[model samples]
Each structure stands twice: as structure tokens, then as C-alpha cells.
Target: MALLFEYLPLILFFVVYKAVDIFWATGVLIIAAIVQLVYYKVSTGKIETRHWIFAGIAVVLGGMTLAFHDEQFIQWKVSIIYALLGLSILFGKLLFKTNLVEKALMGLFSSVQKEQEVEINIPNAIFNQLLVLWVFLFLSIAVLNLYVAFNYSLDTWVNFKVFGLMGITFIAIVFTMFKVYKFLPEEQ
Candidate 1:
């Protein structure tokens, strides 16, 4: 549910693009992003930094796409978002001595542990490896988006954005889960 909420704008953009065109789709994407932010703020009382960053980029890039009547800006948004995310992860570790990936993953696991009365102890070394894995994953996806956007047609790019990138992300999640599975306690 929360995951689906995060992808709502992208999903809407893809659907709108398929039904109409890039410009219309871009407008819907912008509106959807704003709506998402508002919804999150209203529901959670505070929106996450990442959500703000994503919404800001969407509005700026989507606005440019609409203002200039060019689809290139919208196409660039995906790569920009991923690049920023990857950089944030890298810098958080290097400058702040904080591992954002580990924090997020641990927060998630903590909630599950509380609910199921299970203790999952993942080592710091494992978290470090996962952090590197995610940074590379995001950077690779950013590069892949740029490659597909420039080398392919708009239609192809849209399809890749909606389906191909999602497929890659899904695979990465599965891979991460497998990597962490050894840390889980054995069933009684």
C-alpha cells in the first residue's frame, strides 16, 4: 500500500501517456505528485525528505516540459531523480557517517520484528554491503535510463520507464531479500 502510493505518480504518468501524449501525461504527473505530497502531509503529519525532493523535481521538470513544449525535460527527470538518490546515499555515508540505506532497512525490519516477536540481527558488515549494493543499483538505473531515453524512441522510452525499470527494481528487491534471508531466525 505504501509502496504503491510512492509509485502512484509514475503509474499515472504512464497511463496518461498511453491514453493521450507526453504533455498531457506530464501535467498529470505533476498534479499527481502534488496530490501525493498533500496526501502524505495530511495523513502522516510530516512528509519524508525524499518525497519532497521527488515532488520538487517532478514539478520543475514537468513544468519545463509543459512550458517549452519539449518532452526531453520530462525524460530527464527519471535519471535526475535516481542520480540524486544515489548521490545522497553515498554522501550520507561519506560526509555524515550515516548509512541511510541501513537506517531505512533496519527501521522496516524493526517494525516486522516487533509485530512477529522475532529477532533479526543483521551484521554491520552486511548493512555496509547492502548500502554499496543499493548505491550501485540506483546509479546503474540512472545510467540505464539515460541510455534508453537517448537511444530509443519516446514510445520505447515510456514503455521502458514504466515496465523495464520497474522489472529491474523488482528483481533487485528479490535479490536483496535473498541476501538478507540468512539473518532470519529458524522457524520453531
Candidate 2:
């Protein structure tokens, strides 16, 4: 549900882009982001930090795209959001002594374990490694987005943004799941 919500705007953007033009897609994306944010607030009773970050980028950058009738600002939105995610994880680890990846993963892990009546603990060293891996991944995604945006046509970049980027991310998550499986307790 949350995952669907997270990608709702991008999915809508792709649909609108294919149906109409970049300007219309940008406008729809902005609206989708706002609707997603509002849905989150109503459903969860509060907005997550990432939600705010995404919505802010969408509105500001998409607004610029709409106002100026240039698509470049909206094109930069993905790279900026990815960089911000990487930086926020880095800052949280360095300044707050909190590993956001570990924090989020552990919460999900604990819930699953509770349901299965199993327990598995990941060492801090491994969590640190995971955090570093995520930071690098985020930064790499940002760089990749920028490279595609600059070197390719808008239509090509939009395709890369929706399909190519999603393929990379899906592969990344699958790889991470394999790594995580190593630490799971075997069922008796």
C-alpha cells in the first residue's frame, strides 16, 4: 500500500506524459504528490519525513516547470530527491548516531519475526555496512538520473526515469533481500 503510494506520482506522470505532454504530466505529478501526501496524513494521521521531502520537491520543481514552461526543472527533481535521501541517511548516521536503514529495516524485520515466533539479530557492523551500501546506492541513483537527463532527449529521459530507474531500483531491492536472507534464522 505504502509502496504503491510512493510510486503513485511517478506512475501518473508516466501515464500523463504518454497521453499528452511534459507540461501536462508535470501538472498531474504535482497533483498526484499532493493527493498522496494528503492520503498519507489522513490514513496514518501524520506525514513521514520522506513524504514531506517528496511533496516539496514535486511542488517546487513541478511548479517551476509549469510556470516557466520548461521541463528541465522537473527533470532535476528526481536527482535532487535521490541526493537528499542519501544525504539524510548520511547525516542521520553521522550526527544522530542513528542508522535510518537499520532503523526502518529492523522495524519490519521485528514484525515479521514476531509473526513467525523467530528471532534474529543483525550486528551493528552489518547494519553499518548496510547503511553505507544504501548511502552509496542513493548517490549512484542520483548520478545516473542526472547523466540520463543531460545526455538524452526529454522523451528518452522520461522513459529512463520511469522504466529504467525502476528496473534498477527493483534489482537493488532484490539484491538487498538476498543479502538480508542470509541473516534470517532457519525454520526448525
Best by lDDT: 1
* Alpha-carbon shift of residue 114 in model 2 (angstroms): 1.7
Cα RMSD, each candidate = 1.4, 1.5
Query: Candidate 2: deviation at residue 98, Å?
Result: 1.6
Tens-place lDDT per residue, model 1, 72-101, is 999999899888988999999999999998
- Minimum summed lDDT over a 10-residue window in model 2 is located at 172-181
Top candidate (TM-score): 1
> lDDT per residue, candidate 2, 54-107, as tens digits?
899999999999999999899999899989989999999999999998888888
TM-score of model 2 relative to the true fold? 0.93
Write down the worst ten-residue block by lDDT for model 1: 179-188
Error of 1 at 117 (Å): 3.9
